[model samples]
Target: MLGPKIREIREQLGLSQKQLAGEDMTRSYISLIEKGRAVPSQRMLKIIAKRLNTPMEYFLGESTATDTDIGEAVLDKAKLYYKERNDRACIRMAHNVLTLTKDVLDQTEAYLLIMRSYNRLGEYRQALDNGEAAAFIVTRTGDRERIVQYYLEMGRAAFHSELFHAARKFYEQAYTYSSRLKYLQDEHIRALIYLGTTHLRLGNVDQGLEFYLKAEKEARMAGQPELYGEITLGLGKAYYMSEQDGHMQLSYDWTKKSVDSYKLARSESYVLALHNLAVIQLHMGQKKEALPLLGECAGIYDERNLPHKKASILEEISKIYLEERELQQAETVIKEALQLLELRDEGVLRAKLYRLLGLVFHEKDNSDEGYYFLRMSHDLLKRIHAEREADISHQILQLSKQKQKMEYDDYKSYIR
Candidate 1:
């Protein structure tokens, strides 16, 4: 009965023996267990029970056959909803099934899947909330790998929210777990890169550069060019943020290296590298060189149906137009960018777009519009307490006031 049940549940869950095998179990061991040639240990039984969405009692042959039929029905509906990308529905169904069977471990994994779906949908705050809940449950059960993965997902959510410090903390926790386990080398490298990038965002250039370089070397030694590309992009961002003349050149060089590595790996990192290089060129007063790269980035993002990346490229194009003193062109590009913002609900990115729009209007001598958008940006920045963004807002307010006062004085002189 246990052997047939194991095989039945495995097939229903669409999981192969290879997928169910972990550190302590091999595919052959799983096959042996399912064939009734070997009885599983208590822990292994629990693992299989969680994977199959069935209670351990089912395998113990204590449950009535009717229970298996009902459990399979619930699992089938959950699988269908998950396949349809209806994550919330899938989570609800999975939770209800777990309630019926007391399958805490399976419920925890289901919640993680829901959290990932939220992340994919650009619901970072909700994703973080769900991930924290899942992490707590998994950690209490002593599921080390799941705990590590939960922390990594939480870090990604924090990073998206612009909580650089919080993101770094979570990534560090993930790194500790991965290091102690010594088996998840890919995850370890990813944690290192994420931590380094967060440090760069927090203005710790030297430390960030050090971490990025270390990650790059480790990735290369591991023969993982994708990881190498990711770390190089971090290094390039660090150099770009240094805002020093020589560092700008270094930024371009690193960005080029990142692009080359990503291309070799046949990854999406190439698009990101192109965007970063364009930003560097725009800052370096090479608008002509930046525009073509921005166009390429925009096209790639659009092709991939990534509205966030497209919005970012549009904002960069607005900056180039503003720098060139083509105010009308800047305004047009900003409007297009704002349209992209409607597709997703990311407050930080929206705030940034508003700030860029404000700058564009201010350069166009439209003080009223400029001040309005600037104030909107400031309000959003204040909510996040983004100090660097707040500083930029403050500068914009000061300039707006100065420009207004100058216009008033000129009007008075004309009346005299």
Candidate 2:
């Protein structure tokens, strides 16, 4: 069935058996394949299809392949790569599937896989683009679950990129979509979690805490410890950041529970919980207490091959050392963090790293390097988050003992 179609397209393209076979594949094998006397392996079929300028799915006799056919085979392999955190391979395979499948469902799945692979690779803009494509396909499908999932994934990508308003919009849509379904406990809880996170980022801390608490209740009722753990962590963060001092202990307790609950089940959540615990400690000026928490978070990020998380944890550790006036230790962690932030070109974190490095060098009596870094941080602050420029500018001026007037473009000549 497939051989005739392959031969038809091959001939239409004016390609002979030997031309299609290439050096590694014999012409006899190609002849056998075209004669329907032998079958091509999936790999060989892919090569043949590419050479013939047709979707392999076409020759496979499915007008469009489902998410379980040859397209699914690629998806499955991509998923395996994702599980192993081999983002490059996952991304490559996801794109391959995108080109090979015509089924709407299969295409949506491929776009989603590509989105997540880009997310893992820290390509948030590309992640959003692919997520939007997936979302567009499902817009008329009425699969509320998939709609919620699409929004949730996009919201997460935006959140990771520090696009808080965009994240909120996507998460709000996720909640709206999930709410249309009557009894999907998991979807409801997940949507609530993302919505609450967006709320927190938007500075609606009280509202975010309420959603998190509600979600936590539902999670417990549904017997989902992972969801419950995440909710508990959210609650901890809300409380820890609130103006009320009495909530600190509650935050600490809840954060610890989240860490313990997720420690064995969810590696990502476990590391996040640890980071939260460290934040709580740091907020209370207990830098020493935060060290072990940040240390564990760092180790987990490394084990998981998460450069962003690792850089963040390392930055937090450096902050603790800075608090303790441990200049050498602070410098060490800040340098390590810069390497990681630079790898992904994390502008937001890079700005903070520059400021920290600047402070460390200032304390080390290296005025020239200190001034340079602080000025860079100030410039970044002005460009990225202008609201924070006032405080950062003050730091820059204080660091400049000679008070040399460094414009925003001062560091451009040397650094860029």
Candidate 3:
């Protein structure tokens, strides 16, 4: 029974007797064992079981699970780890599934899980590689749904990596595949929404709006409010990019609507939308309106324990104080943002904060202290190879030679 079972599984996995024998045993030995003309020793059995991803107990009649059952069991554990948000463990389990099964669908599932886990962990390169592997396997299965899913995941990974052209290609593939399947309306909507956002990011405002409008109609018919939120966000971006005189007002209104929808869905996107709305208000010279929105975002970041996000809000608030010539308030806010930045190595934001602090000191007529902070900012920017570092270095050298205070415009070159 064991000999026949081994041969059956090996054949099912598309392994020839010679390949199954490996280097540890001869092809003739494998043939003999399969024909029951010879028995495999314990050592050989261990190697065979490992290669076939089978439990040794099964060969000894201590277990009854089929080879496919074992592969599925491993896959299920990987899924469980993914659902628990244990990304590292999920990746490990998925890799185990990859080695244990030769089934195309099972292999595709394992690759998809690994890709998603890598994406969540911010390993976009790994996620993209795994997504590609899954796409190859999914193609062999001719599973249109799986093909669409893999394309979407690949698009997301590429988008996060800022490879917008690659992302657009992947999303286009997903859109094409999903359109052919009548039951994949939800996937079709998703592909459209992502395509719209990608086009907008690539500066194709008209194309983006066209895609968003199409997705909006589909989402409404599907009764998917969550997807509708994405459409509204895309519309906000489109309106903001419009050359019309009321573009800012249109952006504000659409962004505000998106914020409300995201809030109802209890999504983290709500905070981002609110932050964008506040920025628009500032651009429109409604500082009073922007302040309260920044305050709300700061509160949310505090509750979420996201120090970097909170620091960003503080930096924005301090800018308003600086513009108003409230030097003391600006100094205090800048210092608070600096303290938060110290908790992490945010080189760009840290440099900006230092530059701002230096400006505050220069305004107070403390030239020496102001120069010290400005020097620190310049050095940090150079270390990070910031694009404006060369310009800032020249300006700093001039300030050092003349022992003169820098004007507000001098620091404006310090692009965030």
Candidate 4:
């Protein structure tokens, strides 16, 4: 740690250990300082500080608990907050780290932590700013591994910000670098996955599945079953969206593999697999099985305190109930979902909620209330640029003109 502090500061300034050791000290002696095997005398320390253009506090941190130790502890706490999904607390602690040390490496780490915190908090623009700042000074001269990490961070920021093309570009750049470095296989796999997922979001399902398959193979070779399970989840999703005649069966198989794998690991991702599995079962006309899975998924979300996700499951449950002529049950669950959504007010999801409530009221033959909620949902969908949803609303509106008549085909299309 002793020599490493000096080396870190030198590296931030784009100086090699040999260059920092020249004229006064031997390179091997400097290596001993970096390796924590030796400490420099006061005079030697002063000379080294002068050459490195750093304050004596940089070296003092190596000897005392003033900065390095305390700053590292703070960073550890920030990571803990991140893991606990406390974005505000993580952001506060990461900012505290910057105040403790002006070291480029430490500051870079803090910036990145703040970036992730902002992203989790739905502050995409702020997250992207911090992400770009994390890499601005070091992209060309910093450690290759660290530079690749920043690329991944920036790619995620772009993805969350809905800049899918930029996200793909950043992931591709990172994948290119990781390809050249055999030791960066982990990052290589991650970059590939992100690139693939980005393309998937952009509706390039084949390309996305290709990358996911590659990632799965690499993860298996690397003995990382968790990573393989993750890729299988994506593969299932991609196949589900594929328009090919036989892809639905492939989707079921891949989704089953991910569900089984995650259940063995006791992982939260299994809940997502369960949701997908239930959706597939509904497609196969097995609503009897799907309802229980959706109910179980909703209970899990409730226990996790994720009201938005619970609302989603509740909405699904209501649609099935409506199709089964369970009008009162549909009204009950849709109202529950609406109340949950009111707490968080995710507008896109809320639009769907409004639509579901409208349909439930229509199914109950309450034309006035049905028309009102349907119109509300249509306005919201148009505002959100959800043209497909707006079109669906248009259909319901036209049906309202026919005295709220919902034909069999209308019922088939009512499951938003």
Q: Which candidate number would show the highest lDDT if scored against the true structure?
A: 3
State each candidate's clash count: 0, 0, 0, 3
Q: By the TM-score metric, which is better: model 2 or model 3?
A: 2
**In terms of TM-score, how similar is model 3 to the real structure?**
0.64
Q: Candidates' TM-scores?
A: 0.73, 0.65, 0.64, 0.68
Candidate 3 local Cα displacement, residue 197, angstroms: 2.5
Q: Between which residue pairs do clashes occur in model 4? A: 3-33, 3-34, 4-34
Give model 4's TM-score versus the native structure. 0.68
The local distance difference test score of each candidate is 0.73, 0.73, 0.77, 0.76
Q: Model 2, poorest ten-residue lDDT window?
A: 407-416
Local distance difference test, candidate 4: 0.76
Clashes of 3: 0
lDDT of 2: 0.73
Clashing residue pairs for model 2: none
Candidate number of the best TM-score: 1
Residue pair clashes in candidate 1 = none
The CA lDDT at 158 in model 1 is 90
Backbone clashes (count) for model 4: 3
